[model samples]
Target: MATEQPRSSGSNTQRPLTSALAQHTQKKQWKDLSTPEKVVTATKTTTNYAVIATGAVLVAAIGYAIVSELFGSNSDTRIFGDALEKVRNNDQLQEIIGTPMMGHGEASSSKRRRNRRIHSQVVLDAEGKEHLLMRFYVEGPDNEGIAHLEMVKDQRNKWEYKYLFVDIPGGVRRAQRIFVEYNKDAGLPAIDDK
Candidate 1:
C-alpha cells in the first residue's frame, strides 16, 4: 500500500487510558502505604464504641438508683406500723371512735348504721419506715363517711396520720370528716384548722 491509512477519528486515544491506569496504581500504593495509618483508624472506631457503651451503662445505673430510692420499702413500713399501733392504743381514739368529726351527727350515725363494721389496719411504707399502709371496710352516707387512719411517728415522737378512705359511692366528704376526727382523737394538731 502506497499511502498510510488515515488514523480513525472515533478512537479512544492512549493518553486517557494511561492517565486512568496511573490513578489506579497510585490508589493501590496509598493502600499499601503504612500499618500505622490502619491502626489509627481502628483505634478511633474502637474508642467511639467504648464511649457510647459507657454512657449507656451510666444512664441505666442512675435510673435504677432513682426508682429504688423512691419506691423501695427498705425499712419505712415497720416504722409506720409501729407508729400506727401507738396511735391506735392512744386514749383519744377510744373516746372519738364512734363520733363524727364533721357534718350532722344524725347523718354520720346513719352511715355508721349502714356500715356496721368499719375497720382499719396499717402496713409499712415503701421505704420500710412505719408510715405505709392499706385500708378497707369503712362506713358512710352521701355526706358523712368513715375512713381508716395510719399513723407514723417522727424523731420528736409526734404522730402523723395518713388517711385512707374506704370506697363509698358518694361519700368522699364524709370520709374526710372521719380522717379529721381520727387526727383530733389521736391528739395530733390539725394543720388545716391552723
Candidate 2:
C-alpha cells in the first residue's frame, strides 16, 4: 500500500474539534454594574446561597407560626399534660379526646421539640360573650392529632363547652382544615332551638 503524505498548512488543512474549541472561546466583559447588580455580581454564586438561606429561614418562621396558631403556641404554657388534666373533668372533652391514640406516645425529635404548648386563649364575641380557645397536638407514632376546643364562660365563671374538633394534620395543609371541619361536624351534636 502507498503511504499518504502530510498536508501542508493551507485552507484545505482542517483543524481538530479540540483545536476549534480552544480558538473560539470569547471572554466575558467585566463592567461596573448598578448597586444591586454589583451586589449580585460580586457574589454571583454566593448570592444564590445567601438568597436560599434567607428564603429557608423565612419559610421556617412561617411554618412555625401556622403550626403554633392551629396546634399550639410557645407563649401559651397551658398545654399537653396540664391541658389534658383540666379538660378531663368535662364529659364532652373526654369523649372527643379519648381515642386509641390518646395514650403515651413518642414523636419525631423535631416534632417533640417544636410543638410543646397547648394554645389557650379567651375572646369575646359580638354578643360580648367571653369564649375560651384551646388547641393542641396529640401526636402518636403513626398519628398526629390536632384538638381545637372552645368553651364559653358566663358572668358566674362557669364554662360551657362550645365546639370540639379532633383531627390529624396528615402533613398536608389542605387536608388539615378539611379534617377540622369534618371532625367538628361528626363529633358534635347540632344545637337545637328548643
Candidate 3:
C-alpha cells in the first residue's frame, strides 16, 4: 500500500501581483498625515520647487550668455547706436529704403514709434567686416510689428544697411527674447514691458 501525502494549506499560496500592490498601498498611513503635517509637506515641496526653478533659470542664463558670446556679439549697444545713427543720417539708402513698411502710411502713422531698441547679431560677410543682423521693435500698435536686417559698418564706421528683412514672425520674436535674456542688463523691448 502507498502512503498518502497531505496537501499544503491555500493560505501559503502566493498572492497575485495586483493584490500585493494593494496591500502595500493600504499599509501607508496616509490618514495619519495631519493638517499641519500636510501643510509642512506642501510647504517643503513648494520651496523645493521654487529653489529648483530659480537654479534652473540661473544656469540657463549663464548658458545663454556663453552661447551668445560664441555665436552672437557681447556688445549689442553699439549695434543699436549704429542703427539709430543710420536712421538719423538719412544718408544711407539701405537704412532708408530697405527699412520695412507695413503698408501705405495712415495719418496716425505719422506718430513715430517710440522705444525703438535693437537686438543685434554680428555676422561676417565675405568681406570679413563685422555686420549686424538687427531686430528692431516699436511701441506703437501691433501693426507696427518688428523689423530685422543686416547692417554693415563702412570704413568710416558708419553703418550701411544690407539687403535683409526678416518677415519671420515667431522666430524673430523668439530671437528678441533670447537676445534680451542673453544681455540681461540690456533694456527689454517696449513691447515686453507690457
Off by over 4 Å in 3: 1-75, 78-118, 163-194
How close to the true structure is residue 123 of candidate 2, measured as C-alpha lDDT?
86
Candidate 1: Cα lDDT at 105: 14
Q: By descending lDDT, how would the candidates be arranged?
A: 2, 3, 1
Relative to the true structure, how large is the alpha-carbon lDDT of every model?
A: 0.45, 0.53, 0.49
What ranges in model 1 sit over 4 Å off? 1-33, 75-194
Per-candidate total of colliding backbone pairs: 22, 0, 0
Writing each residue's lDDT as its tens digit, candidate 1 over 72-134 gives: 543333333343444344344334342332212123345446423223344555655555343
Instruction: Give the TM-score of each candidate.
Output: 0.28, 0.34, 0.27
| Better structure of 1 and 2 per lDDT | 2
**lDDT score, candidate 2:** 0.53
